[model samples]
Target: MPATPAPAEFPEDLTLGIRELDDQHKTLFAVLDRILAVSRDPYRQLDDDGTNTVLDIMTDLKDAAMQHFDQEETLMDQRDYPGLDDQQEAHERFLDDLVRIEADLMNGTAVPPVRLHADLADQLAAHVREMDRELAQFLNKSEK
Candidate 1:
C-alpha cells in the first residue's frame, strides 16, 4: 500500500527580511497545515479536545498574523512607507480568509483542507512579493 505524505511546510522564499514577521509567517504556514491535516484525518474524528486544539491553532494563527501586520505597520509608519495602505488591505483579506476557515471548522463543515492550504500558501507568497518585499526594500534603502 502507498503511504500518505507529510504535511505542508513554509517555503523559504516567503521570508520578509523582518525577523518577527518571518517567524510568524512560518508559524502560520505550519498551523494551517496542521489544521488541514487534523480536519482531514479520516481515522481521527475531532473530539472536543481535538476541536479545541484546532480552535486554539486558528486563534494563534489569527493573533500572530495580525501581530506581524502590526509590527510591519509600525515600521512602515516610522519610515513613512508608501506601500503601507496596500499592505494593510492585503492583511485584511488574509484575516478574512482565516475567519472563514474558522467558521467552517466550528460548523463541522468539510473545510476544503487541500484548497484552503493552497489558498493560504498562495496568498502568503503573493503578499510577500507584492507588499512585504517592497517594504523591505524601502527599509533597506532608507538605512543606507
Candidate 2:
C-alpha cells in the first residue's frame, strides 16, 4: 500500500461567509480528514476495524449532511432564492453518492480509503464553491 499524504486543511475559498453553513462545511471536511487518519496509509486495504471506523464516520457524515441540507433548503425557501431547486437537486445527488459509497464499503467492493476521501472532498468543495456560494450571495443580498 502506497502512503498517500493526508489531505490538506480545508481550503479557505470554500467558506461562504455564512457562519452556520461555513461551520457545517468545516465539520464535513474534518470528518473527511478522520477517514484519512483511520490508517497510516490510506491506499492500503482497510482491516476489519478500519473498515468499521470508516463505515461509522460515513454514517455520521450522512446524518450531518442531511441536517445541513435541510437547514440550507429551508433558508433558500424562506428567502425565495431562485436556485433553490438546483440546490435541492445537488443535495440529493450528494446524499445518493454517500449511500452508494456506504453500500460499496459494506459489500467489500470499496476503493481505497484515500480515493474515497479525495472523491468526496472534491465533490463537496466544488458544490460549496458553486451552488452554496451562490445561495450565500443571494441570502446576503436579501439580508441587506
Candidate 3:
C-alpha cells in the first residue's frame, strides 16, 4: 500500500477574510499539497511518473494562480489600490519562478518535490500575510 501524502499547511494568520481570495488561496495550497504527496519520500528521487505528475501539478498551480491574480488585480484596480503595482510585480515573479521550475523538471533536472512545495507554500503565505492582508483591509474598508 502507498503512504498518503502530507497536506501543505496554510496558517490561519494568512487568511485575508475575502471570500474569493481566500477560496483561491485554498486552491493554490491544495495544488502545492499534491506536490508534497508526490514527493513524500525525501530519500528517494522521483520516478518518471512522479516527475510527470509534479509537472502537471505545477501547470495547474500556475493556471490557478494566474486566474486568481487576475481577479485580485482587477479588484485592486477597481478600488484604486496603491499597492497594485507591487502586487503585480510579485505575481509575475512567482509565475516566472514556476516556469523556470517546470523547465528544469522537464529537462531532467531534479528538484526535490518536498522542498519545492515548501518553498512555494512559504512564499505564498508570506505574500498573503504582507501584501494581501493590506489589500484585504483596503477592500473591506472600500466596501463599507
Candidate 4:
C-alpha cells in the first residue's frame, strides 16, 4: 500500500467541550493520520513489522473510543440528557463494528491497509460531521 499524506490540518470545528473526549478524538485522528501516511508510502506496507504497528494503533484507537464514549455517556447520564440512550447505543454499535474489523485484520481476512485506512477516514469524517458535532452542540446548549 502506498503512503498517503496526513492532512495538513485537521478540521478544528470538531472540538467538543469535554476535555477527555476531545483529547481522545484528537488521538483517533492521529491514528488515522498514521494510517494515511502508510497508505501514501507503499514501502510502509503492512507486513510482519508494519502489521504490529498498525494493529497497535488500531487497538489504541479502539481503547480511546471506548473511553470517550464512556465519558460522554456518563455526562449524559448525570445530566439526564434526553438523547442519552440513543447516543449510548450508537457508541456501542461503533465499538462492536470496530472490534469485528480489528479481528478480521488480525485474522488476515480483511482488506489491505490502504483500503482499510481509506474506509476509516471516510467513516470518521462523516461521524464527526454528523454525530459528534450534534452531540457537542447538544451538550453546549444543555450547559447554558
Candidate 5:
C-alpha cells in the first residue's frame, strides 16, 4: 500500500513580515495537523481517551492562538496600526467560537462531529486569507 502523505504546511504567502507572528501562524497549522492526526485516525476509538485528547488539542490551540493575538496586539500598539481594532474584533470572534465549542465538549452537550474538523479548517483558512493577509499587507506597506 502507498504511504499516506503528510498534512500540508502553512503556505509561504501568509507571512505577516513580523517574525514572531509568522512563526505563530506556522505553529498553529502544525497544531491543527496534530489535532487532525489524533482524531481522524482510522483506528481511533471514540472513548474517553480519544475525547480527552481532542479536548487537549483544542485547549492548546486556543492558548497558543490567544498568545499570538496578544503579541500581535502589542506590535500593533507599538506601530499604531490602523487596523488594530478590527483585528481585535476578529480575534475575539475566533476565540469565542473556540470557547463555545470547548464548553459544549466539556458539558457533553454535543459530541464533536466529524464536520467540526472541516468547519475549523475552513474558518482558519478564511481568517488567514482575509484578515491576516490584509494585516500583512498593511504592515508591509508601512515598512516602505
Candidate 6:
C-alpha cells in the first residue's frame, strides 16, 4: 500500500478578523500540519498509537469547527444578514464532510492524506474568499 501523503499548509493570506472563527481555522490548520508532518517523516514510522493520535486531533478539529459554525450562524441570525441561508448551508456541508471523513477513518477506509489535505485546503480557501470575506465586509460596514 502507498504511504499516506502530507497535509497542506495554510497560507497567511487566509485570515479573517472574526476571533472565534479565526482561532478555529488556525487550530484546524495546525492539526492538518501535524498530520502532514507525521505522514511525511521517513524516519518516524507512525504506529497504531500515532495513528490514534492523529484521529483524536481530527476529532477535536471537527468538534471545534462545528462550534465555530454555530457561533457564526448565530451572529448572522442576530444581524439579520442577507446571505444567511447560503452561508449556513455551506457551514452544514463542511460539517457533514468532516463527519464523513471521521467515519471513513474509523472504518479503515480513510482517504489518502494528500487528497484529504487538498480537498480541505480548497474548501477552506474558497470559503474564506467567498463567504468569510463577505461576512467580514458586512461586519466592517456595520461598524462604520
User: By TM-score, who's the top model here?
Assistant: 2
Candidate 4 clash pair list: 2-39, 2-40, 2-41, 2-42, 3-39, 3-40, 3-41, 4-39, 4-40
Worst 10 residues of 6 by lDDT: 37-46
| Candidate 5 colliding pairs | none
| lDDT per residue (tens digit) for residues 1-144 in model 3 | 345446766778978888889999999998888886775484356888999999999999999999999999999998999999999999999999999999988887766776787788899998999999999999999889
lDDT of 4 by residue, 46-90 (tens): 666566667777887788788878887888788777778777777
lDDT of 5 by residue, 82-125 (tens): 88999899899989988887777677663443445656667877
**C-alpha local distance difference test of each model:** 0.73, 0.90, 0.87, 0.70, 0.73, 0.73
Error of 6 at 48 (Å): 4.4
Count the clashes in each prediction.
0, 0, 0, 9, 0, 0
Best by lDDT: 2
Residue 28 local lDDT, model 1: 69
- Enumerate residue pairs that collide in model 6: none
Indicate the residue-level lDDT of 129 in model 3.
91
TM-score of each: 0.79, 0.94, 0.91, 0.79, 0.81, 0.78
Question: Which scores higher on lDDT, 2 or 3?
Answer: 2
Candidate 1 structure quality by residue, lDDT tens digits, 1-144: 123336666667777677877777787677767766655452344666666677787798889788888887888888999888888888898899888878877877633445555676788778876678788778878999
Count clashing pairs, candidate 3: 0
Candidate 2 Cα outliers beyond 4 Å, as residue runs: 1-4
**On a 0 to 100 scale, what is the lDDT of residue 31 in model 4?**
69
